[model samples]
Every structure is written in C-alpha cells, then in structure tokens.
Target: MKARDLIVLVGVIGIVLMMVLPLPKMLLDILLIINISMALMILLIAMNTKEALEFSIFPAILLITTLFRIALNVSSTKLILGEGDAGEVIKTFGEWVSQGNIAIGLVVFLILVVVQFIVITKGSERVAEVAARFTLDAMPGKQMAIDADLNAGLINEQQAKERREKIESEADFYGAMDGASKFVKGDAIASIVILIINLVGGFIIGMAMHGMPFKDAANTYSILSIGDGLVSQIPALLISTAAGLIVTRSATKGNLAEDLSTQMLAYPKLLYIVAGTIAMLGLFTPITVMSTLPFAAILAYAGYRMQQNLEQKAVSEEQLEEEQQIEEVRSPESVINLLQVDPIEFEFGYGLIPLADVQQGGDLLDRIIMIRRQCALELGLVVPVIRIRDNIQLKPNEYIIKIKGNIVARGELLLNHYLAMSPGYDDDSVTGIETMEPAFGLPALWVDEAMKERAEVSGYTVVDPPSVVATHLTEIIKKHAHELIGRQETKGLVETVKEQHPAIVEELIPNLMNIGDVQKVLANLLREKISIRDLVTIFETLADYGTYTKDPDILTEYVRQALARQITQQYSIPGETLRVITVGPTLEKKIADSVQQNEQGSYLAMDPGTTQQVFQRFQEQIGRLVQSGYQPIVLASPGIRMYLRQLMERTMQDIPVLSYNELEPNVEIQSVGVVNV
Candidate 1:
C-alpha cells in the first residue's frame, strides 16, 4: 500500500532470504552496522520513556530485531565457511577485541553471553511475567473505581470510557511483553549455538579445502569466528538491557533521566555523608589521601551548590503561588465556578463529621450509594451525585440536606445516642431527651447505649445515628424526585429503553410527542410517587394513544388506566382489601362541570367558594383515614378524578387521587369515608 508499509514487508522478507542466500561481504557489513545502530537507538528511547505504555510497540520491535540478528548470524557463518571471510565489520571487531590474541576475544564474548542470558534476560522475563499478572489482577478494581467516580459525578461518560480503555491497553501491553521477553532469552542461546557452529565449521573448511596447516587454520578461523560472535553479542547485550529497563519502568511524571536526578539527589545531606565516608576511608584504611581527596571535595562542593539551589527554588515557588492566588481572585471564572450549584447537597457540622469519615467507622458514603440505588428502583430516576461536606455555619450537632442549593430539610443528631420511638403509645418509663423523628415527624426519644436494649424490649423502634440521617436524606430526595427529571434526564431514560426496545422508541418519539411532552408525563408520575421502571409498557401506551391528544395530562390519565394492574398492586396487599375515601356524585359533578378549555388545554376553573367547601370536607375524610392508619386514596369517576386532584394537590400532596378505571377489576375496594360539597 504505502511506501513505509511496503518497506517493512520487504525488510522482513529479506531477513528470511538471508538464511538461504549468500550475500556480499560489503552488504553484510553494512547490515551489521545498521543492526548495532538500531539497538542503540532502542535503548535510548526506552530510557527516555516515562511509562512502558509510551512505547507500547516495543514487543513487536523486540521480536523483529531478534529475527534480524539470527539472519545475520546465518549469513556471516556461511561466508566464513564458503568464502574464507565473513565481512570487514566482523574482522575488525575480532581483531580489535583480541589484539591478535584469540583467547582474550573468546573470554570477552563468553562474559557478554553470561551477562545477557543469565542476568539481564532472566530478570527481564521474570519482571514481565509479574507485571502482566499484576496488571490483569488490578483491572477489575480499577474498572469499579472508575464506575464509582462516574456515579459520583467526579468524571463524565467520555472520561470514564477513556480510563477503561487505558486499563485494557496496560493489560495488553504487559501481557505481550511477558511473551516477548522469551524471544530475547532464546536469541541469547541461539548466538552461543551459532558461535560454536562458526568456529568448528570454519576450522574444518580452512584446513580441508584451503590447504592450510593446523596452526594457520586455527589462527585464521579463530579470529573470523570470534569476530562474528563479538559483533552480534554487543548489540544483543544492549537490547537485553533495554528490555529489562522497559519492563521495570513505573508510571511516573518524568523520564528515567529526570526521575534519577530528582529522586537520587533529592537530599543534599546524603551527598555530604558520602563525601565524609570517602575522606575517612582514604585516611584510615591506608589508601592514598591524594586519590580520594579531590573526589570528596567535588562531592562536598556539589552538595553546597545543590542546597543553595533548593533554597532559591523554595523562594520562587512561594512567589509563584502568591501570584497565582492573586490572579485567581481577579479572574471571572472564579466567580463563575461559585455560581454552579450541585443538584443535591448534604452539609453537616463539625461534630457530625465522623458520620461521613471512613476512618472514624462511618458508613454515610456507603449509605448514600445504597440510597441512590434504592431511589433508582423505587422512582425509576437516577439521582444526581449528592455532594457531602461539613459546614461551620450550622450548630455542632446539626445537619441539612439541600436540593438545588436550597435547604429542604434540616435535623440534629446525637451520634452517641440511638433514636427510640414507641410502637403505638408513649413509654414514660423510657427516660431520655425528647425529640421528633425528622423523616416522619413522629414522637421519639434519644436513648444512650445503656437504655437501648431496654427501649427495644419495651416495643420501641431503635435506629442508629447514621440510619436516622440516611432515612431523612432518602425521604427528602423521594419527595423532590419530580424536580430532578427534566428533558435531559427524560432523554436518558428514553435512550436506556431504546437500547432494549427499539421498536417502541423509534415509533413513539418525535412522531406523536417530543421529549418535553414525555418529560411532563414522567414528571407527573414521579410527582405522584409512581415508579417509571416499566418503561417498555409506558412507551407502548404512549405510542398507542398519543395521536388522539398531545396534552400530557390526558395522556397521563390514559397511561394510568393502562397501568391499572400496577397501581392496584401498589395500593392493595395480596389478600387485603384496599380502603379508600370516595368522592360523592355531587362533588364529582361540580368538578366535571367546572372543567374549562382553551387552546393550551383544559383546566379546572371552579369558584373559590366551592373549592373552600371541598377542602374542608376532604380534610375531614383524610383526618379519619390517617387516624385509622389507612392510606388516604380519593376515588372518583374518570371525568373528574384529575380535577379533584388539581384541587387537593396543594393541601394534600401525599394523598393519592385515583379514578375508578385506574384499579384492577378483580380487587375489592372498601370505602371508609365520603367527601361531598
């Protein structure tokens, strides 16, 4: 395809051909020099990389280099045996190292082999294996931490995806290195084998075919063989060291040179100690003081210079920090940052900090995570990250929960005491500070650890401080869940459902209604404490009846009737009849007659006098239902149910107003009271 890719393919093919075809001495010499240069460059690059992943392609490079070296060994061996000479490079290397003495050259070659094979190669292989194992093992933990950060709103979806990809890449890079290290080890062994073959084959060929005596043949072939070995082994040693460096590199902010300079010389005092040691060793151990004194003086001077640099650096850093702080105060973005409000916030005083501190055995964060999950299941809305912090503005034992920067609920906790509430009536004998349960406003007492068991035995519901706070926080979120789901959040729900049920989404959305229309319906349901988890059913209903009316109110009524079974199950127990307050025919007629219509849609326009009478009568019925511990559900005809709800919403927001059709036919309903006006 492209020039570079073609060159790579040709290079690989040439390496294979080198083993079978005899190349010219000049070409072989050039190839050998190129190999050495490549190896040196690789070593330099490895040292400069800050992390192993920065050179992720190294494993492939290692394999290719090893193969190229082996091919060169084969070509060189053939030339010495067949042509009586391998190449000028090999000859120069052999002569230069041996100095016309073959024994010295052979010893030097053997030492390179021992160090490359036994030390560098072996250690690199082990480190690669361990690195790979640890990377793979840490993947799950890293992935979960990313998810937690995403849920906490510390990172967005794109950032989370990038983190996940990085984790997988690290695992793959280490695993490849684990296998690639073996090639370097095998290349070492192959070099030794090729060296032996070159020596034995060259000797036999020189004497048998070239008519040379034993002494002459030994001298000639010995230099050629050792020369070939030395030329290859030098590059192999460099590469082996490079491999070790790459695998052992950790993820830090700087390259090897930078890290070495900063960390090893971080303390100038250490250099002073080393200088003293050198001076003492020369003076007391009978070594020449002249030999060590100059080195010791240089070390002391360097330490002195480094200490001066450190002091100047500290002064410059302080100046820079002050300048940055001044600039930040003048910047518009600083003010802008304060304007951004968190969707939900939990602030507690200093004394209650232990409730959120993990080291103090507090599990408020863990509880918040669970609370978010519970809200998702119950309300079918993803609660935004609850920002938790300590505020010195409040009383020591006081805490407050805010929704959209406005304080919605506040409570005080006695961390050392357990909240004990009587089951039905007051327990005068259970002596403790009087308090009201913040979640439900029920009368309760804060009893210490001593009286906890006694209160429990006396039919009092006991809960710890964390649980009390968690319950209050949960109730506040549930009460305000409708405010949290806007068009953006509704779109999220629609996308989630689209992933699983595409047919309903594609046909319903933007065809009969848009996101805003769907948002209004979802908000209405959440406002009434209805779970929208069954999205497939909701979409199906919307698609079925959406063409008749674009009004969210009427559409919601249709959806409720379609979800009758769910609503029935929500109100009625398995074998118990549902008790409800019934709206009489006279009030229903008044509401139905008062329905007024305009271009925007219909709304209840009843007179204030009739609305007042209705509220007075509805509150009486609701009072009876509450005293009897029955959920105050107002049942009315389909035509007037929504109107009645609109009237009672402000006064009795927690009460459920249901139409007769919004219940299952098989369920029995008992009317406990009637409201007529």
Candidate 2:
C-alpha cells in the first residue's frame, strides 16, 4: 500500500482502539498517539520532497519539559486534599486561581502553543519538499533523453552522448544548489527591517488603542504584562511581512511578487489563531491585554522576518565594483603577455618547444585566438579581452611562448607556451595539471603590511599572515677579477636551500628562471642596504608553509606570480609566475633556490588564478616540502583556526614555533626560525 494509505489505516485503527479497546487508561497514552500522528505527518511530507527540515530541538524540548513539570506540580498540589478533599480541592483550586497562579499558567500555555505552531510549520515544510522530489521521480524516461543525436558528426559524439546520459540520470533529483533555501542577502535585510518596523508600529497601535502617549502606554503595559503585550502584535506582523515583500520583490526583479501576495493571504488564518488564543484565557484572571500583547506581536512578526531573511539577500553595487576591479587586477592577458605567445593554437599542452624557440611570434598568434574563443565558450562571458603583448624570458634554459585573453565566461585565460613541451596531457587532466602548477610558484613568506594599512583605513578585518618567527634570507654574487668566466662554484648552500634533486635542477635549469624578488634582495644585500641577518630574519619569521598563513597581502605577490604560471602551464596561458607564498621550511628553501638559480631581471608576474589554485594545493605540497627536511606552517579559516592553533602548539612546543593573532585585525602569524647549521 502507499504510505498515505497505510497512514490512513493506522489512523482508523487508532480511533477504533480509543473507542473499543482499553489498552491504557492514562492520558499519556493518548498524548503518545497524538505525537505519533504529528510525527507521521511530518515524515510523509519530507519523504516526498527535497527541502531541508530545520527543527529547533532545544526549544521544543524545553517547552515540553516545562509543561510536564507544571502538570506534575499542579497534580501534587491537589494531593494535599484528604477525606474532605473533594470540597477542599475545589476551594484550593479557586484559591490558586485567585492568587494569580492562573495568570502564570496562561502565560506558560501561550508560550508552549507558540512553540507548537513553529514546529508544525517546520514539519509541514519538510513534507512538502519530500513530496516535490517524489513528484519529480515520477517523470517519463523518454522525455529525459539527451537532445543531441549520436549519429550526427557535428560534435564530439561520444562526449555528447555521455553528457546527455548523465543529465538524464540526474534530472530526477534536484541538485544541492537548486534547493529552496538558497539564501540571498536582500531578503535577509528586508526581513530584519520589517521585523523592526513591526515591533515599533505595534507599540504605536497599542498606544492609540489605549488612549495614551506611546511611551506611557509602553510603561503601563510593561507593568501588567512582562513587557508590552500582544496589542501591538498585528501591526508588527503587517510591517514584517511588508519588509519581506520589499526584499524578495527587489531580489527576484519583481518575479516573486505573486508568491509574496499568496503568503500574505494567510493573514486571516493567523488572526483567527491569535483571537482564539486570547479568548481561551479565563475571564476571572488578572490577565490584561497589555501583558499578552508583546507575545502576539512577536509571533506575528516572526513569519515575515523568516521569509524575508530567507529570500531577499542582494549583491550591492559596491561589491560588484570590487569584483570588477579584482577581475582587472587578475587579467590573464597581462600574465599571458608577459610570456609573449599567441593563445589559440597552443592551448591543451601542445606544440611547445618549436613555438618557444621560434622568434617571429607569428605562427603562435592563431593559437592565442583559439584560446580566447574557447574561454568565451566555457565561461559564457563577454568581458573585454586582454592578451599577452610582450615576450617574457622566464628562465635561462626554459622559455615559453605565452598568450592571455579575457573570455566572457572564464575570466582570463593564461596560456603557457610550455604545454607543448609537457607530455601526456588529456582533456580530463588538463585543469588538474593547471591547478597544481600554481602551488609550485608560491613564495617562502608573504608580508601583509599593505593589508594592515587597508584594514586600518577601512575599519574592516584584515587578511594578513600571522607573525610567528622572524626570519630573512640573503644571497651574494661576487664578481672577482682574474676568475675564469666558466669557473664552476662548489656545490654550495643553495643546493640545500631547496630540496629538489641536484640532477633535476641541473636538467631543468631552475636557477635560470626569472624570479625578481630573489635577485632584488641579493642586489640590495650586495649593495649593503639590507644586511644578511635581516634577510635570514625575514625568511625565518615567515609561516612554515611559505605563504599559506591566511595573510592575503603577504602572499599576494607570490600568489599573483603563481597564478600566471598556473594559467600558462595548466590552460596554456603562458604568462604565469607559478609562485608559492609561504614561510615553511620547504617554501623558504624554494625561495633560496629561486634566488640562487634565477638570472638577474628575469622575474615575471603570475595570474591571480594560479595564486588561488596554489593556496588550495598547499596540503599536498607540505608533505613534499617536509620530506626534504623543510618544515611547513599552514593558516586556518575562522572555524578551523582554534583547532589548528592547538595542534600546532602541541607539535611545536619542543621546536618552538611562535604564533600571534593580535598583530592586526583578522591576520594571525605563525613562524619557525631556521637552525643556524
């Protein structure tokens, strides 16, 4: 039988048992049956739909516990009546009522009822969601078929076929993104505004009704009721609903007005409930309208507040402007142009060596155009495009013809000329490889001085790397007369600075890579402007993971450079720096290696995409960095920060890693000083 049919049968049996069978004489049995029925109603609804069910279990439990406690107290109080108890019980009950216990009982009862209403509404919502899902599951199969014909050769038929099948199979179920609780900002604000207005308006209405000034009315009611009673409730409800309407209306671009109106149509039912609750109070009690008004007002306001908060959140113009600026800052074209290659023909890791070697830069232009087209298709965007406009020498031994373009959908394309050099890239692994490349370019440490200044200026939480250890690095290159030009330096400290195999460095010529920071620092140190001690202090002071200390400013430059390289290496957008911004042992070594290996004036800017990707890749890279005798430090988000702090504290007590969160707002610092071996 259907679940609904089974429910009906059970209900009928329950009714029959109530009338014909004496299974239990206690009222608790009846209450249990009622609870079961209520629960079943909720279960049926949720089983058929896809909405999330939110239950305030604590409130419900408290309400129930209080009611039972009151009941037991009252029952025990009646036990005081003995043989003359019949008359005495009645007299005592009357006395209790006369003494204002009745008023307290009524207040408790009202609160419990309100809680019940909330629970019921929540349960009904769950049921509706489940029912909707069940309805979707009942759709016909042929109607779900893919629109494309496999016989047509117009597209990649195999891929098309698979996509269609996947879509069809998943169509029966709603995606997490498609759920009704997709909250918006405008809705939330609207709801809150409306709720506040209702509260204020309710008081005004009560003042008018009581023939007193608003302030006097409030004071008077505050005495009789615990606070301003339900007299102000109706207006508050109206106001809150109106607020929700305004917010939802704005967010939906007026598409949701009808829904708001439909919800408002339930006001009459709310009124009935309110009226009935008021009427249920005893006439002989000292209960005043003032005492009950606030509760009613709160109840009336809650619905509007909830609806508004759930649906009306909006994105402001300021946020949009910021996003646009960020987009400009991270323009893939800039990163790609740094590498100096055409984007189209060279995407997907193909034709790299000859393209990089060829100087004219004409044969690669078509490939750059193709990349732009592909990005347009993928992200479905139409933003102004930027392309790599210059030739960037990335390293002495390795160079890529790079191209960059802005597509409408995908933001910026950082096309690397070296993809043509990497073997074994397929369609699936393309994005994966691109995502990983950025992590390799992160810096050993990121400084957040700019972020701190911005935070002070804006009065907002700053994203800066936490202060842990104070470390620095220095590299010195000497030009001596009479030295052979080809003289090889001994296997020096740089070999140990970065953990890569010496063989790999020899073959890859990582030293030839153009990383400007290392060169600049070295130059400054050689000029005696910055001491070697200061360099070591800077290096050692950074978080162990190089740039992952949750400090945005400190990591931004390295992240930007990494983004450039990642875009190039992964997506064939060539002008990426592939930087890693971190303070861990491994990251510090990488920085040292970059300084030691890279030629002067060879550094490049990375795309923003690579920076974000590298941040994400830190976990995996930490292990590699550590295995090479390099320690890493990682940053934490708000929720995880405390736990991470504790774990780090325990692990580093012996090694002495320091952490400080009070440096600047929203920025924490953790660092490990290098051992002077």
Candidate 3:
C-alpha cells in the first residue's frame, strides 16, 4: 500500500491501543501535545473554509479526533493513578495555569466544561439539525430550477448535472454534521466523568497503597486531577468552538474574518453614532473625563477616516463605471451585436409582470419549458429558448408571441381575473368582461375570482392568466413548427438516429440524397402536421425509393405511405368508422389525365376553365360537409393524392387529403360526401 494509506491505518490502530495499554510518561506527553495541536489546527481550518462543502471530510475527521482524545485521556488516567505522574506536559500545565492553587485550577476546568457542553456544543447541534431539515426540504425546488435552466438553454447538460450533484452533496453534508455534533457533546460529558474518576481514584491509591498522610495525599491527588482535567478540557473547548463555526457559517466568497469585517464595518454612519454616544457618556455620566476622553477621541478619529475612505471608494467606482461605458461604446463588436436576434421572443406589458416573475408566483417560464417538450414529443421539433421581456409601448394587459422577429399572435389578460368559456349551451347567466379565447378564438369572459364559482356552476371552463398565455404560445409554436427545423436541426436529428441505426443513415445520406433533401421532406411532413418521430421507418423508405426520384415532395409522399398505420391511428377515433369525402370516379379520371411530366417533374396541364370547375366543386362539397357537422377529409387515388392536395392547399388549408393506399385494410371507412366536375 502507499505510504499515506499505511500511516492512516497505523494511526487508527494506535488510537485503539492507547485505550487498552498503559503508556510511558514521555510518550504520553508527546501524544498530549499532539492532541492540543490537532485541535488548534481544526479550529483554524474551520474558520478559514468559505463553505461547509469545501471541508466535506470534516465529519469523519471529527469522529477520528474525538476517538483519539478519549484514548489519550484513558492512557493519562492510568499513568496518573498507578504511577502518580501522567506526563510532564500535564504537570507543567497544572502549575502554570493554577499557580499552585488546586481550587483555582478545579474551578477553571469546570467552567470550560460548562461552556463547551452548555453553550457551543448544544447550540451547534441544534443549528445542524435545523440546517439538515431545511436543506432536504428545498432539494426538490432546487432540482426543478436546474431542470428549467437546462430546458431553457441557459445552461448545458454538464452544468445542470453539476448543479444537481452539488445540491445532493449539500444535503448529505448537513446531515453528517447533524450527527457529528453529538460526538462533541458526548466528548464534553466524558471529560467531566474522567476528571471525577481521576480525583477520587487517585486519592485512594496515593493514601492506601503508598501509606501517605491525608493532607499530603489530598494535595498530591487534587493537583494531579486538576492538571489532567485542564489539559483535556482546553482542547475540547477549542474543538467545540470549531464545530459551532462550521455549522453556523454561511457560504461566502471570502473566509470568516473577511466577511465579519466587511459586514460589521460597512456603514461609516454607524461608527459616527458610536463616537457620539461615547462623547455623551463621557460628559453626562459620573465617569472621569480623563479616562473616557482618550477612547472617545480615538473612536471619533476612526469614524472620520472611515467616512473619507467610503467617499473615495464611491468616486473610484463611478470613474471605473464611466470608463467601461466609454469602452463599450467605442468597441466595434457592439454594432455587430445589434444584428443578432432571438429565434423566439415573448414580450408582455408591465401589468403582466407577476405572471412571468417566479417570485410573484408566475409560472410562464415553466409553462414555456413544458411547451418545448410537448412540441418535441408531438411534432418531433426542438423549440428554441423563448426570450421574454417587457414592452412599455403596449397596453397594460397585452402580450405578444413572436417567431424570428415577426409577431405571430397577441392577447390580453386581466391579472386578478379568471377566463371562462361557455360549454356551448349559450348560458349568459354569469356576467363578466367579454373576450375571445386566444388559442381557439372561442368567446370567453374575464371573470373575477369571486365570480369563478358561478361561472363554473354555469358550465364554463375556467383558466388562469398564465395558462391563457401559455395555451396561446403552444398553438403558435405548433403552427410554425415546420419553419423551426432547419439544416442544422435536421443534421442533429440524423446524428441522433445514427447512434441507433447507423447502417440506414450511412446508406441513405450523401449516397441517394443529402441532408438538405432529407430536411425538406421532414419539413413537408411537419407542414402537414405529421410527426417525423418514426425516423427509422422514414429513412428506410427513403433508402429503398430515393434512387427512383431525388424530388423531396415525391420522397415525402413515399414516407407518408410507409407511415400509413401511424397516420390512420392519429386521425381516426377508436372503434369509429373514418368519415371522409370522396371524389367521383369520373372526376378522379379527369385529374389523372390532366397530369403532365418532364425532366423538371410533374405539373397539372388542365385548361384554366376546367381547373376552376374542379376547385368550385370542391368548395361546394366541403361546404356541404361542414354544414352537416362532418370533418372533411378528401380521399383520392395514390397517384393523384399529392396533386389533389397541392390544388386544394391554398383554399382548404385545414383539410387533410389522403390516398386509398395509405389507409389500413382493417379500418372501416364511411364516405359522407362526393365531389363531381
């Protein structure tokens, strides 16, 4: 084993030996000196550590040191009782501190015991117990904050992990301290008990065994007992003080001495007041002027000097700030920085501050984080961090959501009110401010908290202000999700899949199509509100059919056909027939005949009049389907599905066009309407 490990192991074994065996006076003296030195070192280290975690091994060290001290006491007690001399160190201490007065030495030792056990050890133990409880209680909140920062892109994954680990370490450290404090308390009690035993037992041995006179034996044993007690109690007091410091110390950038001086002497006005109070006491009280005037003069001088230093520091700080501002203005990078824009931005009016500020119970940021995760799950897109700020130019209750510097949606909210939407029964019994739901454009009302119960009783769905803005933001992101996935995002997605399906990505990318082509196909799928989460299937379809055509639109259609089961399950209600609108066979044949192809790809070559007639028929049939309360889905042949969707995309953006081949065989279909041209 290494030398350090061997030394530690031997040291621990030596401590156990000290308890079981008697020690020579010379060896006992050396161990006693070492104990005193170790206690002093512990006290100094505790004072210098800026945080508890900086000295995380302190609890284990404390246990070892406490054991070592008790073992030394055992050996010293044996030497003093059996041989009448514990060590030169103990005898010298007893003489120097007590000055031959055994009563004085005994009183001093008892005082130290009381101070350590009653004041420092007890208070530190209580503080450690409370600290451990509170640290564990706040752990969940700290973890959630870390997660929020990670999702918002404020910190990367490594930093988040480090923060989480630090929180856990803090909890464990405080818990260990809570248990370690008990050791110091028990050590204090052991000191007192050992002191009593040494006195009582030493007197009996010196008189009965050595046949000494009563006065001589009393003097000899009392002095020896007092000396031993003082030797042990002094180090115990120092260690107890150190324990107090460790538990009470708050985390700081500076050590204990620096923090104390900086905080205690921060304001010169307080020192000036102290100087004035001393002068008043010197003049108004019975105290002599000669004794008080000098101290008062010193206080006054120190206060004046501190005041001057404060003014100088303020002036220097102002000058430094001015220099920084001048440098920032002169820097060329400042101009370039203005051109950068956030991918997504959220701006709110001053009145809505409480809805975004965490301290004020605003959970808008948390909601935004959830929205990003939701988008990733449903649409397979990564939403960027939304930069939130306040705009004074807008109305007090208004907020806006923007994508890439353009405003997409805006809404207004009342801070102290809940929004209520009717359940389609046209119940107007509950009165409130009328408004429109920002997410769905349904009529809603801003009802006060007192009216929330009545609104609920009237069969209206109620929501809070933050929920309103979050719901609106969710919809806006879903609608513009296609634009968010670019070349970089597409590459990231492919690299992620490559970790799991390396062969498929390697065979398809750069061999049949590049990253940009794949991006376009994914974008097309997202544009039609189809999830690209099944990437393995999408890539497999591309690898099989990409050689036939390099067109992204055609590739997307093939990908859709491969994902037929997922698409059908997404739109179809379980155990219900799929309701759809079908084109008449004659009209389908006409569309098929109108298709034209060239090197540049296919296009519709029908006459303008015939195309107009087809569009009008679609409008009429879709309108009839809507009037009959049926969701309108256009069914067409696989060859014509893409063309049909392209023709109707402008006018029927919400309608989903499907091919017969994309439908599963087990799914039952019901044609609700027919189109003819």
Which candidate number maximizes lDDT? 1
Model 2 gets an lDDT of 0.32
Clash counts for all predictions:
0, 118, 0
lDDT of each: 0.91, 0.32, 0.88
Relative to the true structure, candidate 2 reaches a TM of: 0.19
Q: Tens digits of per-residue lDDT for model 1 on 57-131?
A: 999999999999999999998898888788889999988999989899899999999999999999999999999
Error of 2 at 648 (Å): 72
Q: Per-residue alpha-carbon lDDT of model 3 for 1-677, expressed as tens digits? A: 99999999999999999999888899989888999999999999999999888888888888999999899889988988898888788888877777878888888888989999999999999999999999999999999999999999999999999999999999999999999999989998998899889888888998999888888877777777788888888888888888888888885778899998778777767776777788788899998887677887888788788889889999999999999988987999878877887888999999999988999998888899999999989888888888999999989999998888999999999999999999877676788999999998999999998999999998999999888888899888877878888899999999999999999999999899899999999998988889998999999999999999898888889999999998898778878898888988888888889888888788767778977888898888888888777778889888888888888886777789999888898899998778877
Q: Best by TM-score, which number?
A: 1
TM-score of decoy 1:
0.70
The candidate with the higher TM-score, 1 or 3, is: 1
TM-score of each: 0.70, 0.19, 0.57
Q: For candidate 1, what's the RMSD?
A: 8.9
Task: Give the poorly placed runs of model 1, Cα more than 4 Å off.
Answer: 1-46, 49-105, 113-232, 239-329
CA lDDT for candidate 1: 0.91
